[model samples]
Target: MYRPPHFAVDDLPTQQALIRAHPLGLLVVAGPGGLTADPIPFLLDAGEGPFGRLRCHVARANPVWRTIGAGAEVLVVFQAAEGYVTPGWYETKRETGKVVPTWNYALVQVHGRARAIEDTDWIATQIADLTALQEAARPEPWAVDDAPAPFIAAQMRGIVGIEIPIARIEGKWKVSQNRPEADRSGVAEGFAAQGAAGAAMAGLVRDFGRERG
Candidate 1:
């Protein structure tokens, strides 16, 4: 998280928004066994604390849970709307030929003390809420209760829940904000032409670029 002044995003709401939009986070931990990382989908409860609380789960068979001691410090990284920006997209490339390629991205890094929970009720509620969040837009949404009770119980038995109360959060939005107005506009136009894959980034570039200008 090397955040330059231009790329730093300190707003709490903005950081939480990215987490909600990109719920899958890279969970990192350093324990007695050493450092380990895993990709896990998370739920953010923004009102829970000064920063917020994060909830997620992993398979019981996964060794990650075992490594996390009570209140162990951990980091979860959430990334949204990112892409490669070619130097060709910068107007400066034509003017002075000084621009180089770079990656444009928006991300949040949350540092927290993690606790592993084995309570069945907590895990059940966590999975249900997570499922609803992801399935709300689907025409035919599925629920944890949709399956047989025994089957659901059996499946739940194989997983463990994780909860983290956020201690610190940092957001970085490198969306052409460091570029000049003309160069930023060039980036917006180039990314806009890329359709859905670039839509989010294009909007970010335009909005942040305008703010800077």
Candidate 2:
């Protein structure tokens, strides 16, 4: 991640929050054939290691697990929020007509050595935890135990578990922090007028933009 100082997200708590909110990660690794990327939802176990650990699963038939061995280095990319930033939103565009279009988004990249887990007990526990995390907000939350044990066990057989003890994390939050205060405000206002998609970007600007000096 090539992040400029103004757009970097170095706070540990902030990065962790982003991961929890956006649990799906693009898991990428080098394989015998080439690079393989799998979109997988992860569970962040903050207490597992110094940095943390990521737990996810892939289908047993997915060739990625076959070529990428246990303990191989991998990257999991978590994308938080993203939206297009129109040049027209910048005050500079009106003042000097110098601004061009750019994108505003938040993302985190976690680097670690991944290990495949074959233990049925561990995989079951992970699936249950992951299910709880995602279903917690529902009025009637569903659980892995909702189904029959034999059925759950049979379903689990079709997948393989993977874990990564995080080595490093890089986060980038490009939410118009580099722009001047007036320009930043302009962008937020512009987004507010554009509806829900743009309003999401506006919310990020309001939250993180205040932190900028």
Candidate 3:
């Protein structure tokens, strides 16, 4: 998370919001082999810890479960992203010189201590909890019990649940914040002129300046 000063996201509440909105994330950890990363949907488990925790699961046979990795550090990157800033978007292009293209996006990185929750009951509980979190927006949602007991038990046996206690959070939002005001405005205009999500995100980045910072 080597963030330049201008593009850094230092606000705690904003970081939490980004994590919540983008609940699905990339979970990365250095393991017995090297570094392993899994694209996972997680529940941001917020409670007593000042920084909260991350909870997710994967298939037990996935090989990420074989190690005894309690207390090992992990990183979860939740991305609230928009992309592909074209060379045509910079205000500087009109002003002085031609600039190479660049990208614009937003993301939050949470560093944490991780452990495999080995107890079946604990794993089941976490599954139930995570399922609820995913189903929160549904009016009539499915439950874990939708499957046959034997089938679910078999499925559960194939998966492993993980818990990560977040220790440090580093969030970076590089949505033209590093640019001058005219350049930022130019990017936003360029995005809007194209009628894309990038423009919408540019607006968000602008509004975010007034809020998060």
What's the count of clashing pairs in each model shown? 0, 0, 1
TM-score of each: 0.96, 0.95, 0.87
Candidate that scores best on lDDT: 1
lDDT scores of the candidates, listed in order: 0.92, 0.88, 0.78
Per-residue lDDT for 1-213 in model 3, tens only? 789877787788888888888889998877889998889888876663987788888887777655536777788889886777776777798887767788777899988778887678977888888787778789987788887989888878888888888899888887777666777777777777766655667676576433223
**What is the full ranking by lDDT, best candidate first?**
1, 2, 3
* Tens digits of lDDT, candidate 2, 3-114: 9888888888889989998999999999888898999999998877777899998899997776556789999999987888888888898899998899889999999989
Of 2 and 3, the candidate ahead on lDDT is 2
Model 2 TM-score is 0.95
Structure candidate 1, residue pairs in collision? none
* RMSD to native, candidate 3: 2.5
Q: Pick out the ten consecutive residues of candidate 1 with the lowest summed lDDT.
A: 204-213
Candidate 2 segments whose C-alpha is farther than 4 A from its true place? 210-213
RMSD of each: 1.4, 1.4, 2.5
| Model 1, global lDDT | 0.92
The prediction achieving the highest TM-score against the true structure is 1
